[model samples]
Target: MSVTVREVATPEPGRGEVRVRVHGSSVNKGDRLVMMGTPYVMRLALGLRAPKHFGLGQDVAGVVSAVGDGVTRWQVGEAVFGELTLGAAWAEEVVAQADQLARAPKNVPLAEAGSLPVAALTAWQAVVEEGRVEAGDRIVVNGGSGSVGSYVVQLAKARGAHVTAVVRAHHADRAQALGADAIVDAELEDFSATDARYDVCIDVAGSVPMSRGLRAVKQKGTYVVVGGPTDDPWLRPLLRPLGWMLRGAFSSRRVAVFVARPTPERFAELAAWVEAGRITPLFDSRCTLDELPQALAELESGRRRGKVLVEVHHRV
Candidate 1:
């Protein structure tokens, strides 16, 4: 009943699909929530009993083993990576929609490349697409030490924005080292009441007050959310990055919700960032498939400093 790899028929690529021999898969916080089958709501899609999708991982990096009809953007043996909807990534082979996968940078390791899919896209969408943030803009990234938060700091800096990161005192050094112009130890400082308001805000941690977060941004400034879970799953929805986004738009301050979709363009840009050395991998370690349960527990504890990758190459 576990999401362990088993002997199954090798799935052939359908039109617009590619059969990928999975090398590595990066774990997500959402993956942990679904795995726990929390609040009985996640089970509806994951499975009423066991997970419908047997493979556990959602973000993947691997080589294209076979390309199906109408697939022209890639070829066999090419390294590619992307995020998946119903994760089948904890396997030796997976069928991926061509549009969701992008060519990995030649210089980046496959294991680290898998880390880009969800987190990087979330940062890019918040800063690039929805936030419409520009250089010299003053920005605040709440939970700036988390997976997506780290990327937001780097991306905001690349855009020439003056970035402030709200993280724990323990994580202030790491966030600052990642290029945050200013660091706020939320554990020790009052972020909302600070006179230093921002032109834009990206909430990836969901730890700050909803209304207070909106107020933290200057008039005509924008706020976007990217994370989705907390201790209480139900409240997590309202407190999530998306829910905060909805509440922001209705208020006088501009608010936008971004569910970072798996797109080729975004994936390509992230890969380029990695290639150019503009974005470095924040991957900390790899957890085997058997360690999934413990890993999920650790993630829920809210202490993981970086991406926890799941190695899927053992099936070979």
Candidate 2:
């Protein structure tokens, strides 16, 4: 059931689970896809008529208020962050598997912490997990102004690599502010036509053609697709990943799709990076809780610079 600011039953921590009083939930590209049901395949599991979990939010950062009987490593009132299994985040309370919860970085605000789980994890899986992008590797993050794309830019830079940000002309300046060594305005410059090459090319924009993305990378370079329309019969949510894997096998050039699940270890890594100031999660705009409906509309319109955060409580 979905509700807000009412006496909804507070979720209780089940065995191996914990309940969190959420402070903020950040909207992301996946959340946008799940909300729209565009590819005609997402509803097979997420529910056809209306989603199982009525709440829409996903990336959560808040304080643990209760714990399940078997969970001992965590205590009540500790700041924490993670992804929920379904769509229970927009609501005031959420119950998560205990093993997935992670302590928030000591120096980061809960609101900013909420932005990292999904977006950053996808970037991590792409650069670190699939691409094996090491120090000095050249990475190009297409659509660098969006949530995941923003993190990819910062994280790639943090890895001691050369980073180029590709975004629409309007966001070019903002991308540079986030430490992009250079910016490519997709509107003016056809990044596909450029002869320059990168070791790893991450595409979050989805509008860019797969062939064009592949061309921007050098021989044996990695091309990662995070979201978009896909051609798949099963696991619609994973179509992009599956397609990349299949095509990559036949081609000499590397192509991979990135899908990441939130885990305590990965969340911890995100929190640490943010707290240490090595990675800065560019917040496009901080919206109030009541502004969620409007924010979703704007987000779906496809013009945002960074993470669109719904901050429930100001940093205290």
The most accurate candidate by lDDT is 1
TM-scores for every predicted model: 0.90, 0.89
lDDT of 2 by residue, 63-173 (tens): 888999899978998998888867567757788887887888777677777887788888788777777778999888878887777778888888888988889887888
Give the lowest summed-lDDT range of ten residues in model 1: 230-239
Which residue pairs overlap in candidate 1's backbone? none
Query: What is the model-wide C-alpha lDDT for candidate 1?
Result: 0.79
Count of residue pairs whose backbone atoms collide, per candidate: 0, 0
> Per-residue lDDT for 185 in model 2?
82
Which candidate gets the maximum TM-score versus the true structure? 1
Query: Worst lDDT window (10 residues) for model 2?
Result: 229-238
The C-alpha lDDT values of all candidates are: 0.79, 0.76
